[model samples]
Structure formats: C-alpha cells, structure tokens
Target: MLSETNKKILSLAVPAAFSNLFDMIQVIVDMIMLGRVSPVAIAAAGISMQFLGLLYAFMASFSVGNSAVVSRFVGAKELDEASKTTFTSSVIAFLISIPFTIFGVFFSKYVFIFMGSSEEVVKAGETYLSIISLTFPVIFIEFALYSSLNASGDTKTPLKIVVVANVINTVLAYTLIFGKFGFPALGIKGAAIATAISYYISFVLYLYVFLTKKSIVSFYPLFVKDYAKRVLGIGIPAGVERVITYFSFLLFVKMIAEYGTYTLAGYQVGLRIEGLAFMPGFGFTIAAMTLVGQSIGAKNYEEAQKLGWQTAKIASVFMGFMGVLMFLFPQYFAMIFTNDEKVIQEAILYLKVVGLTQVPLAIGFVLSGALRGAGSTKLTLLINTASLWFFRIIPAYVLSKMFGNVLYIYYAMFVETFLKAGILYYMFKKGYWKRQVKWKT
Candidate 1:
C-alpha cells in the first residue's frame, strides 16, 4: 500500500498529469478545427505552433531553476526563502524574455525562414508567432507563479486555472479561427490570439493564488541584482540543455518536413498524443523535483532519494497502463484529431511506436526531474543532448534513409529513451548530483 507521502505525491501528480492531458486535447481540438480548412493549413499550424515552443523552451530555463530553488526552500520549511525566491524568479523571467520577445515580434517571418519551413508555412507562422510572442512575459510570469505554488503543494489551483483557460481558448479558437460568433476568421492567427488571451487569464489566476492564498512564497518588495544570477546559476545550464534538445528536435522536424505534408501532420498529431504518456511521467517528475529539492534543503539526502524512487515507481505504473491503452486503441484515438484516412493511418503508426517507449520515457523524465531538483543540470545537459543527437536524431535520419518509414524513424526515438533512462538511472544511483549544486537558495 502507498503511504501518506505517496498519496500526497499523487494528489500533486494526478492534477499535473490531467493538466497535460487537457493540453493534448487542446492541441487535438486545434487541429480538428484547422484540418477542415486543408491539410496544408493543419501542417502550417502545427509547424508554427512548434516554432512557438522554442519560446517555451527559453521560458523553461528560468522556470525550471526557479522551481528547483523554490521547491528546496519549501521542503526545508523555509517560508521566507521560498517567497524571496519566487519574487526573484519573476524578475529573472521578465529579464530573460525581453530579447526573445523583441525578436519574435520584429522578425517572426525571418525566424521561420531560418527554421527552414515552407514559404506558405512561414507566412502563416509569422502571424502565429507574432501574436503568441506578445504573451511571452505573461506566460513566463504565470509559469513562475504556478511552479512556486505547486512546489508549496498547491497543484489544484494551476490545474483548475489551466482547465478554465483551455476551455476559453477552445471556444475562442473555434469562433475566431472558423469565423463563428461573428468574429473575423483569422485562421491560424486566430488560434494564436485565443492562446494569448488564455495565458492572460491564467496569469490572473496565478496572481490570485499568490495574493490570496497563505503560501510559503509570497511576493516581496526588495529586488536584488544578485538574485538573478543565483536563479540563473541553475537555470542557465538547464535552459542550455533544453535549447540543445529543442534545436535537435527542430532539426528532426526539418528532416521530416522534407518528406511531405501528410507525414508532418501525422507526426504532429501523433506527437501530442504521445506527450500524454510522458506527461504523466512529467507530473511525477515535477513531484520528484519538488520533493528532492525540499528534502535536500532540509539536509535529508536519504529522504530525497526515497522520494525520487517512489515518484519514479508511480510514474512507471501510470505510464505503463497508459501505454496499454495507446497500443490497444490507436485508430480510435487518431480519429479524435483528424478524419483524413491517410493522416489517421500515419498517426496510428506513431502512436503504437510510442507505446513501446512509454515506460522508458517515464523513467527518463522522472529521474531527470529528480536530478534537476538536486541541482545537477550539467549532467542532464550531457545525457539529454548526447542521446538526443546520437541515438535519436542521427539514427532517425539514417533509418529514414534506409527504410523511408516514419515507424522506423520513431523506433530510433524509442532507442534514445531507453538509453537516456539507463544512463540517468545509473548516475542518479551513484549520488553524484547530490554534491554538484551548491545553491544557497
């Protein structure tokens, strides 16, 4: 039987996992609406949406570090330190978003061009990126508040807010993108607008949690320049790790783009569904990070390791069950996103491929999250970047060359997940991460 702490972790992980599933549903809904226009429209939206994820990649840098610090403080029962870290994290997130926001607004088109998308996709993407970029600071700040709150064991608030926001996004995406509700049909651009508005709504909800709720981390007045570096010390490497991984994935997308529109659309849809499996893993990952960071802060390395493995076990069980559903119901699931037979067939192929990798993916995410909570971003950087490029990206291209099958290409990704999980598990067991970070926060 799970203990009280295990149950507490689930209370956090379940909400977070459900939150990710909602996001995946949101993506499917977006594609279902967009797919009616044309396959090109769907692919264009998917590619641009992905390009925006690059921006999210940057946001994660500050947020990840902030969460690590915040979680540790909470674990240590250091309320003042946690609150101070929250304020510092907000300021740091704002500072980091400035240049990216500017570039996204001014050169949205050129950036898409650089990403090597088609002329049509680039033009459509510029609209999506420009509008979405406007919400970067809002999104990051919202992320900061949510991470801080969740670390304090308040996952329900973020989940509730995100669900409400996604519902707004859903209705607006339908009305604005499809010319319903007497709104101008803005197509992909309309979807971006809806998303931005949702982020604003979420920001308001986060503001409430911090303001109204009695949490360990409350926003404070004193702003310190030194705090930014302290936040970035852990954040920068974590961010760099993500950037490398994103760039590699971006390259993988570019390679797949060369194949055709159907392939890209199928891959895009399948990817979102696949995220559902890993997202449950991600929920536990968040728990692992929070528990480990806080445990270490309390000077309880023994508790940290115990929390880490417990989280991993829960994640594995959940993901394994989800994998069964994914493998068993591929066609039924594919239909939720698109009706195009060809697209559905391709998506089903990727879904089944994902099933085989779900357990490994769970381990990789949960263990890595635990390691990051230990403030060992450099190790994560090396493990993720190396396996991503070596096992997945390179082999994906080579396999596509050999067989011309996207299934074979995804098989390479499966291999990469196992490799990452294996290596990370070993490092985590050895206890090197416990000493790597000297963070005072």
Candidate 2:
C-alpha cells in the first residue's frame, strides 16, 4: 500500500496534471483550427503565443510565492491566516495586472515591434496579444485563488473549475473561429475571445469556492496591510526570473527571424508542438513546490527534501520519454504543423536538438519549483535572471550575429537548459532553504 504522503501528493498531482492538460488542449486545438487558415497565420499565432506565455510565467511566479506562504500557514493549522493570505494575494495581483491589461490591450503593436516580427507577423500577433491582454485581471485573480486553494488541499475544486473553463474555451474558440454556433468567424481574435471568456468564468467559479467553502482564509481589508508586502517580496523575484528567462527565447526568435520567414515559421511550429511535454513537467513542479512548503512548515525538512527528489524523478522520467519520441520522429510530428518542405526540414532539425534537452529541462522546472516552495524566491530570481541575460540571450545574440544560422540560434537553448539544470540541482541539494525565515508576520 502507498503511504499517505504519497497518496496525498498524487491527489493534488492528478488534478493539477489535468488542469495542465486542459490548458494544453486549447493550444493543440488552436494549432489545428488556425493551421487550416494559413501557414502565415499559424506562424503569427505561434510567435505571439510565446509572448503570451509570459502571462502564465508571471502567474506561476506569483502563485509560487502565494502557495508557499499560504500552504505553510495552512499546514500549521493557521486557517484564518491562510485565508487572509490568499485574499491579499488576489488583491495585489489584481492591482498589478490592471496597468498590464491596459498596455497589452492598447499597446500590443509596440510589443510586436520589440519582438522583431515582419509586417504580416506583426499584424496577426498584435491582434492576438491585444485581445488576450484584456483578460489580465481575470487571469491573475483566477490563478491566485486557485493556487491558494490547491495549497489548502482543495485541489479537486480548481481541477473541476478548469475542466469546465477549458472545454468552453476550446468549443468557443473552434466555433467562433469557424463561424459555428451562430458566431462570426473572427479568426485569431476569436481564439482570444474564447480564452478571455473562459478565464472570467473560472474566476467566477473560484469566487464561489472562496466564499462558501471550509476555508479559514477570508477577505479582511486589514490583512492586506499585514501580508501583502511579504507576498510581493517573494513574488518579485519569481516574476523577474520569468521576465528574464523568456526574454532569452525572444532573442532566439530574433536570431531565427534573420534566417528568413520560413525558418522563423519552422521554429514556431516546433516550439508549439514541444509545449506538450512541458505542461506535465510544470504540473509536477507545482506539486513539488506545494509539498515542500507544507512539509517544511510542519517542521519536516526531510519530508520536504524527499518530495522535491521524488517529483524531480517523476518529471525527468516523463520528459525523458517525450524527448525520445520527439528525437526519433521529429519529421512525422512536423507534418502536423506545416506542409512546406523547407519549413518542415528546418523544424525537424530544431526539434531533434531541443528534444534531447527535455529531461534536463524537466529537472530545471523541478528545481526551480522546489526553491520557490521553500520561500527562497530571491535565490531563484538571481540565478534564473542572471542566466537568461548572461548565458542564454547574450550567447544567442553573439552567435546569431556572427554565424547567422538555425544551428547557431538553437545552440543557446540547448546550452541554457543544461546550465540551468546543473545549477538548479546544486542549489536544491545545498538545502539552505531549510532555515526558517524569521520575518515578523
């Protein structure tokens, strides 16, 4: 029989995993629907989707900070404090997301310019970016509440909520994109609208859970003054980590762009398909972070370490299997993305290179997730941010400028994944996060 701890972890992991699957179903469906529209549209949506991933990264970071602290409090049986923690985090995320919402909606054209896409790419991406950014507040609030609830051991609620939301998003995106269900065919913008509607629906469902549940946490305006600063303190580092890491990918895209539209388009196809393996790793990472925080909060450092290692092993095993499939059959998968032979060939090479790196990539996610769970976001911030600029982005810019080829561009991704995994494992095994943070709460 499995131990209770193992069983507990799976209870959260299974739902967390499904939520991620639901999230990916939308992406997979989008590629199918939009691929029929035009290769240009597919490429545009693909590149634009990378930028949109920043939204999730930011949400993950905040959720990391929030879940660690909230779970710690809950594990200590401080239910009221835990409730207050979540409510405060949600408010803070809401406030911060508003300006981003405005900028994302109104200034998306500028964002695309920074991304170095062509005129056609810019026009398609800007439309998608603007529409998705409109839902920033909804995204932030839903993420904050859901992460808190999951940490509080209500994992099933968020899973159910996401299932309902993602189904709506997929059906609506398809229907609106194809002029089904009495809807106009709005193309990429229709996908955005579908996503935005789903997020709002998820938020409404989360609100219901927050209000009517067995939660010890509640919204008290005074707690914001008390807990909000700590939340941001932990969050800002995680946020910086994301901003820096993805910026490296942006540089890679820029380098790929110099090779011509087809090359850039190929990289986009490979990337969107590659996202499937990544989602599961992310789910396991979330589980590791939550488990570590709760264990350490209960003064069980050994359990914390065990949780991290086990989750790492699981993620590595899963990603390793995925890496093999991608490595062995890159071209077969490439066909799903595009029929252009040149695009297919370039995509095949890129996929083969990146596929070998997936297990290490999984290790990196696990390490970072473990660090965040221990409330050591500052260390993660410094390491991940510095790596993005120093190791990943700078190298790509140099190689791409001098060599100017797909191989040179993708090398940076390969190197960065290896470096981060090595560094993350070192820091994780160092076990410094076991020290109790003595800040007055």
Candidate 3:
C-alpha cells in the first residue's frame, strides 16, 4: 500500500513521465523517418539536435529557477508572487533567446562542420538547424509556462498540451518528409519545420491558458528587481553548469564522430532508446524538486528529506527495470531506428553497457533535483562540473586515445554515472541544502 505522500508524488510523476516519453517520441519519430532516408541523415539530425540541446541548456536554467521559486511561493500560499515570477521568468527567457537565435541561424553550418561531419551530413543538417533556430524564443516561452505549471503541481496540463503538440508534429513530419498528402518532400528540412510548428502550437496554448487565468499560476505584470534577482541568483549558476556540461558533451560528440558516420548514427539511436530509462528518472526528479521546494518553503525540512529519498527510491526501481529490458532487447531497439547492420551492432553495445547504470542515473537525477529545489544550484553546479570533467570527460578522452575503441567511451560514461550518484547521495544525506537560505517571497 502506498502512503499518501507516495501517492501525491506518483500523481505528478506518472503524467510527467508520460509527457517526457512523448517528447522523446517526437525525436524518435524524426530518427525513424530519417533513417529511411539515409544513415547520413540520421547522423546529421543527431548532431544538429545536440547543438539544439546545448541551446536549451541555457533556457533550462531559467525554467529550473522559475520552478523552484514558483513552487516555493505556492507552498507559502503566496499566489501573487508566484504569478509575478512566471511572467518575469518568461520575459527573461525570451530576451536571452534572441542572441542565441541569431548565432544559431548564422553559424549552424560551421558548427556541424566543426563536429567533423561529412559534407553531405553538414548540408543535410544546416537547414534543419536554421529553421529550428527561428523558434528559440517560443521554445523558451513554452519552457517558462511548463515550469510554472509543474511547480504548481499541475503536471497533467502540460501532458495534455504535449500530446496535442506531438500529434501535430507527427502528422506534419510524415506528410512533409515523404511528400504524403500532396505535400512536397522537404527531407530533413521538413522535420525541422514540423518541430518548430509544434513548438509554436504549444507556446500558443500555454499563453492562452496563462492569459485566461485558468492555470494554477496566473500571469501578472509585476517585475520587482529583488524577485528577478532571486530567480537569477539561483538560475545563473545552473545556467553556467549546463553550458559547461553541454559544451563538454559537444566535445564528446566530436570524439564519437571520429569513429565514423555509422557509429555516430548508432550512438544517436541508442541514446534515444535510452530515453526510456530517463523518462521516469526525469519525472521523479520533477516530483522531488517540487515536493522538496514546497516542504522547504513550509519549513518542513524532514518532509523534504523524506520526499527526496522516496522519489529516488521509486525512480530507481522503475529505471532499473527498464535497464534490464534494455539489456535484453538492445538489438531490437537498435533495429527500430536503423536497418544498417553496423549501426545496429554499435547501438546494441551502447544499450547493453549503459543499461547497467540506470539505477545510478536515477539516484543522480532525484538528488540533483532535490538540491535544485532547495535553491542549492551552486552546489549542484560544482558537483556536475567536477564529476563530469574529472570522472567522465578526462577519463573518456584518455581511454579512447589508449584503446581507440568506442566501447571504452561507454565504459567511462557508466563509471562516471555511478561515481556522481554516490557523491550526490552522500551530499543529500549531509543536509547542506537545508541550511541554504530561502528566497523571500
């Protein structure tokens, strides 16, 4: 029998998990469709998506900060403050996206080339990257809205919105990618356009919900300097952390690229399939963050600790089970994305190696989210930077150079996940986040 607390956490987690899964499905659809075009197409889209992920890493800082602040206010019964935070966060996200949009549009070709992609892959990816760049502002806006809603304990609304958005995306992608229903075949460009369109649809829906005052948090036109500072104070460290993390990932991708296009495509496919494990981890992370933030806001430190551990425990079970499935059916999952025998073989290796680490990954995600919720972004930043660079990146680079084998890179990844998870669990037990000062609403 589940306790009430566990029920509340799962009430949020189930919907959020499905939402994240659907979000990944959008990309999986793209990969599957593009795989039919060519392995080069899959590789190109994968690299371009990584760059896009880098851009979203910046936006995630604001989204994360908004979630913490808004949830804290909600817990404290400061509805007005929560609403104001949502608006201000959205504004900041939009403003920050402008320069990134310009940079992405102008330099996407160079970025793909710099990743060591072949000429065909680079050309295939450039248009896709450029089109998606145009939607950067809306993407951030949607993030703000989702964060605000999730913080207010309304994960189901975002789940509904994402469902409709993905439906739109899938239809557009199918029609435009293959010239179905008399639409012109735009290849990779069609996938980009579909994604951008879906983003806009979600953003519009979010904006309407906020404006109509139907959401848990309403939009208000109050922008206090102190409030902005509070959000950014927590956010900037997160932003820096993500920027460094994604930059490191870019470097990792570059190293992977040296292995060849088929290898890169396989890695990308394995990564997407691996999202099955992450979906639950991410959902539980959100639950942990929200519940932890609310508990802290209400000055119930014990409850916060309990919620964090409980969420991690739940996430670990589900993710561990998923890992077992991944290990068992690695080849089957690989075949869903690509028919290339070499690519499927490589993806199978990645899936099998990474599958063993899902429980550790769950621990890391939940604990990190707990820390973030308590406004301990600086600590997380430090942990992520040190663990990622020292444990993951440096070891990976050295092992790859020594062995010249992609399997060694995956081994490094697996080892680093466990190391970081242990450190995060230890830090959570030490209770540093409880001592952190709370923002005044």
Candidate 4:
C-alpha cells in the first residue's frame, strides 16, 4: 500500500522517533526520581536541566551542519567525504563543549542563584549541575556520532544503544538515590552521578560502533579544515539561532519563576510530560532532513519538496493525537512526576493550555528541519529568532506583568506557535531554500 518513498521515510523515522523518545525518557526519569525527594528538589533539578539544555542548543549547530553535509555526501555516493566530515564535526563538537563544561562545573552555584531560586533550591541545583557538567564533552561527542549515523541512513543502531543506556540510567538512579544493592544514599548527588555514568557509557557504545566499522562512517580522527569550514559555514546561523532562542526561553522560565517554587516545579513537570509529543515531531523532522538532503544531492528538487511535505503530514497526525490525550488527561500525566497538590494543579493548567498547539508545532518542526537539510539554516535562524522574540517572549513578558495570572503567558505561547507554523509553511511552498543554497561540496 505504501510507495518506496513513503516506506523509506518510515524506515528512517520510526527508529529515530524511538531514539528521541528514549532520550527524553532520560530527563523524565531524573524528574521522577527527584520529585520523590522534594518539590524543592524538582525545582532545583529542573533549573539544572534547563542550563544543560542551553549548552545542547549551542551544540545543535554542529549536529545540524554535519547532518546536512554528510547526508549530501552519502546521497552522492561519496563515502570518503562523508567520513571526513564526521570526524571533523566530532572534533569541533568536543572542542566547543569544553568551555561550557568548565563553566558549568565551576559556576553552577552562581547560575542557580541568578535564576532566583530559594536558598535550598540553589544549594541542591548547585550540586546537581556541577556533577552533570562533567558529561558535557561526552554528550557532544555522542551526539555528533549519532547525527552522522542518522544522516547516513542508519538510525536503528543509535536507537538500540539509547534504549540500553536508558535502562542503565533508570536502574542506577533507583539504586543510588534510594541506597539499594550496597549503594549509599546520595540524594541529588546520586541522581547526577547516575546521569553522568549513563552518558559516558552511551559515548563508549557509539565509539565502538564506529571503530568496529559497523557504521557507515568510520571513527578515524581527522581535522579537515575545508570540511570544518564548510560545516561551520552551514551551521553557524543555526547555532546563533539556538543561542538566541535558548536565551529567550530562559527569560520565559524566569517569568514563570516569578510565581513561586511550586509553579516553577509544575512548569518543569509539564514540559517533561509534553516532551512525549515532541519525540515524534523530532523524529519526522530527521526523516525530512535526511530525505530532502539526499533528494537534492541527486538533483531531484521536486522529490525533495514532496518528501518534506509528506513528512510534515505524518508528523502532524501523531502530534495532534498527542494533543488530544494531553488535553483530556492532563491531571493523570501531571501526577506521574509529583505528589504536591499545588504542583499537580499548576501542571494540569499548563498541559491543558499547551495541548492545543501541537499540530502547528509539528509543522514548524518538520519544515524547519527540511529547510536546514537543504542548507537554509540562515533562513531558519532569521525566522526562529524573530518569531521567538516578537511573538512569544516579548508578549509573554508583557502579559506576566499586566495580569497576575499565568494563563495569559500560556496563551502567548500558543499564538507564537500558530504564527510560526504558518510562516514556515509559506516559506517551504515558495521554494526559497532550493534557490538559496549553492552546494559547496
């Protein structure tokens, strides 16, 4: 019933979706374990995760650029070029992550205090953030390899590795946090240690895959300046976009924090739960990126456009269904992460409010990936930065000040998603990306 093109999309998308889901599970597990500790624990860990997220956002440039370049090479049947790009990208990723890792380890306490947390939250977050920071280089290296494999049309290997790593994280967190099986109870420190261990293991597994020649790309370390330049040239805009976007998001988080500790914790819980909807959207986005990049490399421009739209159509269906479930069962989902009645109530409101935005969010996700895959990262950078500040952040800030209720802030988020989705659809249809990129490879 499905064409080969459609089947190819699913082949890449399904495994990638599961991988993203498992990745989110790692964070959700942290929240769940910490939630049992205290509401303050939840708030503290949440802030630490957000800071880590900022670092990931910056690293996204290398991943996105690497995917675009490497996918094009694979499509063109240039395996040697693809392998060189991967090694250079990985090296760049490791180098850039070092500074952030050092900053996070040394200045984590100051970061929490600047986040306007209570004294208990600041102390707890300091411990968690400092421990987690040790894994920044490991995470970047793992992600570089992960993205390379996906671009080369091998998503299943990464998926398998992530599932096993997630299991390890869960079991370790349970034993360490509760002092089971000869482990001493270390509270937040224990959770952070579990997280760091799992990341290192995942990196090692990825390395093994490359070294064994099981992967499409090999693990030989190379520093190709031309390749690195090309990758960064394509990625810098996306990276800059991420820096601005995350900064804006942190401001949004600060606004939510103004309400109180319980509200911040509830917001974090809702975000972790809503991450369920994001996994499929992200997966399909990868599918679009890979398919479109390959199609363009073969110079089949129409097929590239068709694949992009097809990916968006499928992603919207899954995301829309998730929205319905979130709208109907917000309370049940909220309860999984926290027992505090106040936190539960706030999370319920957030889920109910955000549930309606899923479909548009899906379109935004897949289309942007398509554009970036075609080396239109600059376009995405402009659109995302402008829409975030104009439609989301500024309005949310004004609403937070004008009304005592947080409901207006949630409404602003919905409006931004709707507008951004529409703009992305228009850009994709106009075929600007095809004209904008002149492939250097």
Candidate 5:
C-alpha cells in the first residue's frame, strides 16, 4: 500500500518524467538522423551538444531557484509573491543568456578546436552551434515558465506543452535533416535549425499560458530588487555548481575524444540511451524539490524530510529496473542510435559499466533536489564540487593515464556516484537543510 504522500509525489514525478523523456527523445532523434550521415557527424554533434549542456546548466540555476522560492510561496498561500518570483526569474534568465548566446555564435569554433577535435568535426559543429545559440533566450524563458508551473504543482501543463513541442521538433528534424517532403537535406545544420524553431514554438506556448493567466503563478509588471537578490542568492551557488560540474564533464569528454572519434560517438550514443534510466531520477528530483519546498514553506520540516526519503526510494526502484534493462540489452539500445560496429561496441561497454550505479545515482539526484528545495544550495555546491573533483575528475584523469583504457574512466564515474550518494544521504540525515529555509511572510 502506498502512502498518500507517495501517491502525490508520483502524480508530479510521472508526468515530469515523461516530459523529460520526450526532451531526451528530441535529442535522440537528432543523433539517430545524423548518425546515418557519418560517425564524425555524430561526434561533432555530440561535442556541440555537451557545450550546450554547459550553457543550460548555468540557465538551470535560475529555474531551480525559481522553483524553490515559488513553491514555498504557494505552500504558504502567498500567490502574489509567487507571481513576482516568476516574472523576475524569467527576466534574469533572459538577461543572463544574452552574452553566452553571442559568444556561442561568434567563438564556438575555437572551443571545438581547443577540445582537440579534427578540423572536419569543428567545421561540422560551427553552424550547429551558431544556429542553436540564437535560441538561448527562448530556451531560458521556457525553462523559467516550466519551473514556475512545476512549483505551483501544475506539472501537467509543462508536460503537455513539452509533448507538443517534441512532436514538432521530431517532424522538423526529420524533414530538414533528410531533406524529406520537398525540403533540401541540411544535415547537422538542419537539425540545429529545427531545434531552434521548436524552442521558439515552446516559448510562444509558455508566453500564451502566462498572458492568459492560465497558470497558478501569474506574471506582473513590477520588479523588486530584493526579490531578485533573494532568488539570485540561491541561484548563483546552484549555477556555479552546474558550471563547474559541466566544465568537469567537458574535460571528461575531451579525455574520451582522445580515444577516437568512434569511441566518442559511442559514448554519446550510450549517454542518450542511458537517459532512459536517468530521466526517471530527474523526474523524481523535480518532485522532491517541489514537495520539499512546499513542506518547508508550511513549516513542516519533518514532512519535508519524509518527502525527500520517499522520493529517493521510489526513484531508486524505478532506476534500478532501468539498470536491469540496460545490463540485459545494452546492444539493442546502443544500436538504435548508430549502425557503426565500433560505436555500438563502445556504447555497450559504457551502458554495462554505468548501469550498475543507477540506484545510487538516483539517491544522489533526489536528495540533492530536496536540499536545493530547502534553500541549501551552497551545501550542494560544496559537496558536488569537492566530490566531483576529488572522486571523479582527478581520479578519472589519473586512471586514464595509468591504464590508457576508457574502461577505467567509466569505473571512476561509477565509484564517484556511489561515494557521493552516501555523502548526500548523510547530509540529508544530519538535517542541516531544515535551518536553511526562512519564511518571507
């Protein structure tokens, strides 16, 4: 028998999970379509996508902060404060995306080159990077809107919108990438343009919802500097954490690239396939964050703790099942993304190694989300930075050098996830996060 709290968490988690799954599918569609062109194309798109992930990490800080603050307000029955938070977070997201968008368009080629990619790969990635960069502001806005809705316990709206957006993205990607339906084949660049167009569509949908006041949190014209400070105070640490985390992952990718283009492509495909397992964790993280924020806002610290644990338990079960599938049928999942034998082999290896760590990964994901919701962003920052560098990055570099095999790299990731999961559990149990939240009313 499931508790009512567990049921409510799933009500939010399941839809959010499906929505994230669709987002992953959108990216997979791009990879699958591009994989037919060449492994180099796959590798190029993968590298560019990683850079985009880095940018999104920075943008996610605002969204995460918005969710925490807005959910708390809603919990306290303060709809006005929630609305103000929504508008301010959206503006901040837009403002922060501008410089990154400009740099991505103008100088992204140097980034690929510096990552040690071949000239051909760098050339293939440049246009893709430039086109996608143009959509950063739209992406930021859409993210903020989604965060606000999720905070207000309206996960279904974002889920519905994402489903529609991904359908459009898939159709556009296919038509443009293959020059289908009387369109000229644009290859990787076409895929980028399709993604950019889809983002604009999503932005419009989000704007419509806001303007119509269909969301629980409505937008207003006023800007409060103190509210901005409060949001950013929580967001900056979260953003810095993501920036460092992604930067480290970029270095990790650079190391993988040294193995060969086929290996990098294989790793990329493996990751996309692994999203099947990880998306559930991400979904539960959202649920945990929102529920915890609301609970804390209501001044029910015990309930917030319980919500975090329940979310983690459910996420672990789901992720563990995914791990079983990954372990049993790694090749099947790997093959869906690429036809190359070498790429498939590398991807299979990655799936098998990382699959074993899925449960612990789920724990890390949920607990971290709960802490963030409780406004313990700085704690997460410290733990993630220390553990990531010490347990994953430094060890990965050392092991890769000593063994000169990609297998050691995957092992390092497995070890890091387990250790970090334990550390997060300890922190959650210590209950320091309860003190972090302060009611504004």
Candidate 6:
C-alpha cells in the first residue's frame, strides 16, 4: 500500500528519528543529573551549552553544504566525487575548528560574564566550557562525515554511533558527576569531560567506517578546490544563517537570564523536554534534504517537490501530537528533570506556550531542509534571517520591555513560528528551486 517514495522517506526518517531521540535522551539525562546538584548547576550547564552552540553554528557551513552537494552526487551515482567532497569538506571543517578551540579554552569565562551570569554560574560554567571546547575539531570532523553519510542514505550508521556514544556519555556522566565507581565527583566539569570523551570516540568510529569503506562515502583525504568552492558556495549562506540565528538565540537567552537563575533553569528544563518533541521533525527534515537532493540530481524536480510536501505533512502529524501532550501536562514533563516548585512553575509556563507552535515549527523544518537539498541555501538564509529578527527577536525585545513578562516574550516566539511556516510553504509552492539549481560536476 505504501508508495516507494513514502517507504524511502521512512527508511531514512525512522532511523534518524531514533538517533535524535537518543541524543535528546542523553542531554535530558545530563540535565537531570545536574538538576540533582542544584538549580545553579542547571543554569550553569544550560548557558554553557548555548555558548557552545556557536561551534555548531560554524560547523553548519561545511556540514550543510556537504549534504546539499554530496547528496546530489550520490543520487547521480558519482561515488568518487561524493567521497572527495566529503574529504575536502572534513579538512576545511577541522581547520576552521582549531581557532574556536583556542578561543574557547582561553576565553570561556568572558563569555559567561558577557551573558550576565551570576558569580556561581560563571564559576561553574567556566571549566565545563573549557573542557568541551577542546573537542571542537573532533566535533567538526565527525559532523562533516556524518552529514555526508546521511546524504548518502546511511542514517543507520550514525544512529548506531550515537547510541553507543550516548551510552558512554551517560555512564561516564553519572559516575563522574556522583563519584561513583571510584571516580572523583567532578560535577559540571565531569559532565564536560564525559561529553568530550564521547565526541572523540564517536569521531574515531566514524573515521573507521569511512576508512574501512563501510560507508557510501569513503575517507579519500583529497582536497579539490573546485569541489570546495561548490560546497562552500552552497554552505556559506547556510553557515551565515546559523551564525546569525545562533547569535540571536544567545541574545534571546541573555534576555531570559535577566529573570533570575530559577527562571533560567526552568527554561532550560523546558527546552530539553521540548527537544524530545523535535526528534520526529528533525528526522523528517533530514529525510527531505536527502531525498530532495537525490531527486533533483536525477533531474526529477517534480518528485523533489512532492517529497518535500510529503515529509512536511508527516512531520506535522508527529509534532502536532507532541504539542497536545505539552499543552495538557507540562508539569509531568518538568518533574522528570527537577523537583523545585518555582522551577516547575516556570517550566510549565514555557512548555504550554511553546506547545502551540509545534506544527508550524515542523513545517518550517522540513521545507527549509527541502530547499537546502535543492541547493537553495540562500533562499533559506533570507527567510530564516528575516523571520527570526523581525518576527521573533525584535518583537520579543519590545514585549519584554513593555510587560516585563516572559510569557509575552514566548507569545512572540509562538507568533513567529506560524509566520515562518507560512513563508516557507509559499516559497516551496512557488517552485523557485527548480529554476535556481543548476548542477555542476
């Protein structure tokens, strides 16, 4: 009864969804352990993670570009070219990560201070940030490899790697955070070490897969300037999009920080819980990106368009169901992370408010991914940048100043999601991507 396209989408999406689910579970476990330590601990770790997101923002450049380009190559049956692009992209990503590592090691404390964190939080976050920063190159290289693998429809490999990595991270985090198994209790620092170790191990596993030729894209280690240009051409806009978006997110977090430690902790808990709902959407987004790229590569633009809409429709259903749960019983979710009454109340407000936006968020995720797959990164960049700033951040800023209520700020976010989804749907329907993409290589 299932169409071949539908089955292909699920084959990619189902594995990816489980991968994201495990990833979220790992983060939730970390936050749960940190919460047991104190609300300040949760705030410290949460802020540190946001600051670290800058590294991922930078990684987005090559990772996304690699996906857009390499997926097409795979679709066209050009395995050698895909391998070269993957290798070139990986090298560039590693080089880019070095400076970030140095900066994070030396200047992490300054980031906390700049974010207006309290002394306790600043002290707690400093070591964690520094330790996590050390893994930047590992993170960058592995993400590049993983993106290539997924583009080639090998999501299952990454899922396996993540499952093992999460197990290692969770066990190490629990042991080191609590001084179990004769390990000294390092608290936040322990969490950082666990994360760094898992990243390094995962990178090694990914590299092994490529070197052994177990993956669709092998580890060729060749640098092709033309290929690099092709990749970066598509990636730069995506990278800029991520950089600006994350910077805005940090600014958004800074605004939330003004509400005090308890509120920030609550927000962090709610974010982790909300991330659970994002798993299905994230999986389908990857599906759209890969399938669309492949379809476009085969010069089947109609199939590409159809695939995008199908993926978005499926993602909306899953995310909308999750929205219902969050809207109805946020406190049940909040309790899994922490027991503090004030924190629970703040988290409850956040979950309930954000619950309304899940379907729209799902729409935006998959369609933008589809656009990126069609080599329309610039279009996505424009849509995301304009929407984030004009609809979300600026409005949230004014509302926060006027009412001084985080609820109004959240409502601004809720409104922006719908607007962004509408714009993305319009662009996807307009079929601009069919005209925009002209394949080279």
Winning model by lDDT: 6
List model 1 lDDT by residue over 1-441, tens digit each.
979988978988888877777777777788888887666567667766676677778776778888888787787788877788788888877877888789878888886687677888788878787888898788777777878877777777778887998899999998888899788898887888888888888888788767765555788745656666656877788888887888887788877777788888888778767776777887898888888888888888988888898898888889989888888898888898889998898888888888877788888999999988888887888888888989999999999999987777788988888999999989989999877757564
lDDT minimum window of 10 residues, candidate 1: 221-230
**lDDT over C-alpha atoms for residue 56 of model 3:** 75
Q: Which consecutive 10 residues in model 6 have the weakest lDDT in total?
A: 47-56
Clash pairs, candidate 1, are 72-293, 75-294
lDDT by residue for model 2 over 166-245, one digit each (tens)?
88888888888888978888888787788788888888888877787645554544456657776777777888777776
RMSD (CA, Å), each prediction:
2.8, 3.2, 2.5, 2.5, 2.5, 2.5
Residue pairs clashing, model 2: 83-217
| Cα lDDT, all candidates | 0.81, 0.80, 0.89, 0.89, 0.89, 0.91
Given candidate 4, what's the lDDT at residue 372? 90
| Candidate 6 regions with alpha-carbon error over 4 angstroms | 34-44, 117-124, 254-266, 338-346, 400-405
- Listed in order, each prediction's TM-score against the native is 0.90, 0.87, 0.92, 0.91, 0.91, 0.92
Please list all clashing residue pairs in model 3, or write none if there are none.
none
lDDT of 6 by residue, 1-441 (tens): 988978899999989999989877787789989988888788888887777677778777898999998999998899999999999999989888888889888988888898789998888888888898899888888989989999999999999999999999999999998899999988888899999999899999998999999987897778999989888999989999999998898788878989899889899889988998888888999999999998887788998999999999989999999999999999999998889999999999999988989999999999999999998999999999999999999999999999998888899999999999999999999999889998966
Q: Tell me model 1's lDDT, rounded to 2 decimals.
A: 0.81
Better of 1 and 5 by TM-score: 5
